[model samples]
Target: MEKFEALIGEMEEYGRSNHVPIINEKGMPVLLEMVRQKKPHRVLEIGTAIGYSALLIANNSADDVEIDTLELSQERADIARAYIDRSAYKDRIRIHIGDAGENILKLSGKYDFVFIDAAKGQYPDYFRKVYPLLTENAMVLADNVLFRGYVRGAAECPRRFKTIVKRLREYISLVSENNEFETVIREDGDGLAVSQRLPKENNR
Candidate 1:
């Protein structure tokens, strides 16, 4: 475990230097704790940016956990695959390169744990696609949902990011309003929306 932690530190440094977005330290503990408590058998991650978060999940999860991660950019996917191969959880993690929406539909088995950290604007669509694949009591965590706090405030955001902010607001509302799910918005890191699918009996 010490060796893995060291490797994760190295990866974090690499991500910072390379300008690749990875999970922040504040958000790491939240994810780690969720994995520890959930003990999910199958985990799904939407963004495979350099594989930092995916590796983190794999390292913290049970030995039998299977992780499927998606990446849109082939270049990024290559780098992520290399990093994952060097990790102890390499065999348990699978990197799927392509659009997340399409690849998500191709997944066969249901996942009890899902982490979404991909394009901020596509979060609602991703949620729709992954919703059907979630098992009872499944946990779906969406990272960067707050988008640097712009989603909550009226502060002027850059024109390029306004659409993303708008979509994220919609996504948050959709999840929070859904009766089948219970959602909590955490202020860790950029922001995280930790949602759990309610049992059929409890949905009412």
Candidate 2:
């Protein structure tokens, strides 16, 4: 994992200079491997905090895939735009500024993958929004579900972030109990949940 940490350092340094949130490169590489395996045609990302994760997904895929990312924070969105504008990947990624849920509702095309890394409390809401946009066999990945190991102790957390953590657990549990998709929780930077849509016959 030393080599992975080196990459994460490099990404964090870049983010420091560019004013964006840096993704955990070590954790992200695993997701990138999954992207490479899936070879998705289109990707929808709900959080573009400086576009780190979206960029990773795009880089792992062939040139044909298009990545659309949403960011609610205008400052972060501008930072992402600047970084994308300076990079060769400018054309491959489009960062939309607004509520991710609203943007998802307005999106016209289907996606082969969706990445969720926004506000923890909104996971279920975001899932509902993105569900209709996913095609058969599409996968959705939600990050930081463990909430720094506080999800299990949400009741003890301070009231503000506590509610969100509780909601996230509920979201995770709901997904776990559902039969329409298969979900796997990974122990990585914070935590990761990967859910792939099951075939139509498997849906209730």
Pick the lDDT winner. Answer: 1
Each model's TM-score, in the order given?
0.96, 0.86
Stretches of model 1 off by over 4 angstroms after superposition? none
| Residue-level lDDT tens digits of model 2 in 2-43 | 243344455578777875555565567668867998888899
Taking the tens digit of each residue's C-alpha lDDT, what string does model 1 give over 1-204? 237877888888999899999988898888888888888889999999999999888877777999999999999999988888887888899999999999999999899999999999999999999999999899999999889889997788999999999999999998999999999998898899999889999994
Error of 2 at 185 (Å): 0.4
The TM-score that candidate 2 achieves is 0.86
Q: List ranges where model 2 is wrong by over 4 Å.
A: 1-11, 16-20, 153-155, 202-204
